[model samples]
Target chain A: MSGRNATIEVGATSSALVALIRSEWGKAWSVRAPAACLAGAVLLAAGTAFTLANDQVRAMQTGEIPVGTLVPVAEILASSVMFAQMVVVLAALQLVTPEYASGQIATTFLSHPRRWVVVLTKAAVAGVLGGLTGLLTGPLCVAATELALGDAPRATVPAAEAAVMTAGVFACAAMVAVALGFLTRSGVAALSVAFVLLVLTLAAPAATGKVFPGVAGSALVSGTGDPYARWAALLVLLAWVVASVGAAVVSVERRDA
Target chain B: MRIDDRARRPAFRTFVGTGRQSGPVIVVPMLQFAEISKRYGPVTALDHVSFRVEEGTVTGLLGPNGAGKSTLMRLLVGLDRPTSGSATVAGHRYRDLRWPLRVIGTHLGGRPVHRRRSARAHLRSVALTHGLARARVDEVLELTGLADVAHRAAGGFSLGMGQRLGLAGALLGDPAALVLDEPVNGLDTDGVRWIRELLRLLADQGRTVLISSHLMSEVQLVADRVVVLGGGRLLADTTVAELAGRARDEVVLRTAEHGADDRLRALLPDAAIRPVDDQCDDGAWRVTGASEREVGLAARGADLTVLHLARETADLEAGYLTLVGDRGQQVDSVEAR
Candidate 1:
């Protein structure tokens, strides 16, 4: 028989890819990763409302409308997504790195001899889970914050857009974390590198905005360093995910697992 | 051994749209290594080593600790790429294979299984990966003697239990070929025997099985053909019978007589004679190398007494040691020169 007979059937490859996504999501669902991320989003929303609530009480006492008295649900949801991004990065670092450290990757790679398939499957699962979590948590946080603050801004289309934009950011960052974990194959090293990069990204723009006035200074917002420039951040983060994950997958196949 | 056509099970047809055999002959080589070389920075792991693994035989990749046994196994499964050459399993390189898990099974490190998941779940994941029926999970679990603990979490398993679980996972897809590296390392005596039986059965089923081990004794019992390597080079590639024949350098003999050792030494030049120092050796000499008839003739010629004259047979370990030792000496002398 030609050695080509050894090629795994297409049916098997598709099934394996599906199974990988299901199992990865299953693992995340079973653990504290998703729940913890939701909690962080809830906390951010509550914190944003508490600030609005205090501003309202002070306005009532003084018999005057407080400046920026009502916090927009859009702003609250955006902050919620930023907080979710932090939690997702932590989750990716903690969860994905175990497969490498515990030698599970060996079995995983052995099971799906196609290296790129495995890498892409893992990223897809992580990205999907991050999206789902944001979809669920974003609206819930907005609702809770509205309830907490008596005169809080109601849910708007912008809040939904902000939520999706937030989800995209978190998902991109989480995927990057997974990719880095695979490349470094060391949990602590990958997480440290991830955290350091995040810090640099957050810090460099703020420093640059401070040095330059007007357009540049307006780019630095408090919650995520800058909201207007987030598209650029998203692109940079996506590129990171692709390059790191591509390198990791290729190296895994070309070199030893 | 001839395969009995009558004993062949009916071709399995799971469903109308399920897996179907496309051809009569699966003519691809079981495994092919061509001019494979691996270098780790300043150190070379394997150098231009090449070999083939055919179906229905247990092929042993034998080498000492630094001879690249693990490296070669890694290269074969695409865990590590060859620096120059290529290794193909069945007919395709690992990365090119569409469904790898179902085609070729590999057990690289004997690391523990996923402790959080049950053995059954572990097998299920692998089976699912290959699009194999879920029933195959239980089949392999049972085959590896892991049925009793199939529902138990793999994390708390003993080392032997973990090894069995790993084996079960490897067999999940009913792979056509198996590449196991030190599969018996953590296995107990029973586990070792179980693997030996398992490999033999797989080979008997017309599947290629390549097992790598530095332990000659482990490979000796199972390997039909041995590929002995030293310093990352192929030293001896032959059948067990051939290796045994080549190792038949010493002939054993025993006699009871004072100064018989010296007399036998004098009779046959280059003959090694030593006094038998066992509990039964009461002034008896256990000499070797000379044939039985020659020893008798020597005894008569020396006017010595004969007690025991049985030829000592060389076992696999002895044969392996002899082969490796000879190669090692040649290497040492070459380095010296």
Candidate 2:
């Protein structure tokens, strides 16, 4: 049939990039997986923090434990960041895998043929969502802990710093998950790897009295390790994000869609 | 075969709201495949195929299953790169096009829609990536007759509806070039007619439309030119009428005389005559080289009463079958030898 009179104009590459990012954001939330993961993360964090605070309060009141040894709300909230990180990993993994599994990547590449743009836009969307989820969950965990402990001595850290660090670590973990998603292009495989890594990182410090340099969980939660150790942890995590995502970008660019 | 520049500009550019240019227009083939070859490890899909699709024409890519139609289309769309040579659209590779959808719209076979997303939502999401306005989404939905079910999840669509959705997505950009692979698949009679008219209209507007289909009759009806492929090799690139004309036509004659077949064979020594028993009083003969009038006159000269004398013109299906079937036999004979 005769096409309509209106002709579409090609936008600038920057505008196209922005539009791709927006489309990625919409796609991220279009499914129920990301929302369910965020909710699960919040629930797990609050539940764990409240349980720990309640136990400490009961022990101190019954003279079974000393009040001075009670963990503070800030540390409980910081530790709860791990729960949020787990959810972020799952959400980020879901973001890219479903597209690949459904063969929607073909359509995406058709619209924006630049492979790097697709990779980075997806990563950026997942990272921002993960960070925002962390920022919200951190305070909720602290409130749950404080409410449970009542007037007990609450350990505290600067709220602003805690939020920023929590967001940053979660964002980093999300970027790693995005990279893993691209590398595996399978939801089950990426999620399994993320789970194994998170569990191993959580157990490493207790078993060896120190976590691996690549594991940022220990440094991120307590924020109290030696300056060199913390810097090393941050560097390692950053390196993982960069290297994995870089590899993913190259793979996507070179492979047929 | 080279196309002149004057014939490559959109004939109905004024019909669309695109502004007229004051300077000389630079003409280029809407789609060009130059010595393109594709291989998957040890298996080759396309073998150094070359063709050009000019503006304002419908070119049918006619081939059988496994004849590399899909591979050629994928190469043009940049989903799969050619192993050698090049495929370009408006003088630029598909991947390098600044506005891909705006320049060329493509719809490959099968339903590529996300199952969970609504049709409108899916189109809107795709439109966003190209910075297209939401109005364009509505227009395509309306054009594809999908407006009624725009909000329903695509998972529930029938096969025909899915095809319509795919066509809708292709037209979303209102591109100057359209590439469709089996667009008529799963369509009902009316749907097929509708698509045929739509394609003809698009070509009339000076747009380049290339469609791949194995249905020779359908292609004959809609395509101005047909590019035939057999066993991943280019067989014939010519107009439908030309291809049909290349095939040999025959004249069938029946006479009451018992020795009429031998008499006709002797009269037209150059003609290939074959006898046929139609279970009638008179026997029938198929004459290839002579016209119906000549056969009738010869029958009268022999004092034979001719019962039937008519010409059977070769059709597109006959031509395609002859071409492909002959090629198959040649390959078999070579292998045997």
- Report the lDDT of model 1 for residue A18: 79
* Candidate 1: Cα lDDT at A188: 80
Q: Rate the local accuracy (lDDT) of all candidates.
A: 0.65, 0.77
Candidate 1 residues B1-337, lDDT tens each? 2332323422111122224676344455668888899999989888888888865568888767788888988888777878899998755687666666666777775653455667777676656565567777777877888889888877778878887777777666666678887888877888888888887777666666788876667687788898876777767777876776766645555556565666667777756666666554454665556777777787788877776667777766566667677445343322110
DockQ of every predicted complex: 0.33, 0.34
TM-score of each: 0.81, 0.84
Against the native chain B, each candidate's TM-score is: 0.81, 0.83
Quote the positional error of residue B5 for candidate 2 in Å. Answer: 17
- For model 2, the docking class works out as acceptable
Give a tens-digit lDDT track for model 1, residues A109-198.
776767677777777777776666566555665565566556543334344654566566656667777787778888788867776565
Candidate 2: TM-score?
Answer: 0.84
Off by over 4 Å in 1: A1-68, A152-159, A203-237, A250-254, B1-28, B214-218, B249-260, B269-286, B296-309, B326-337
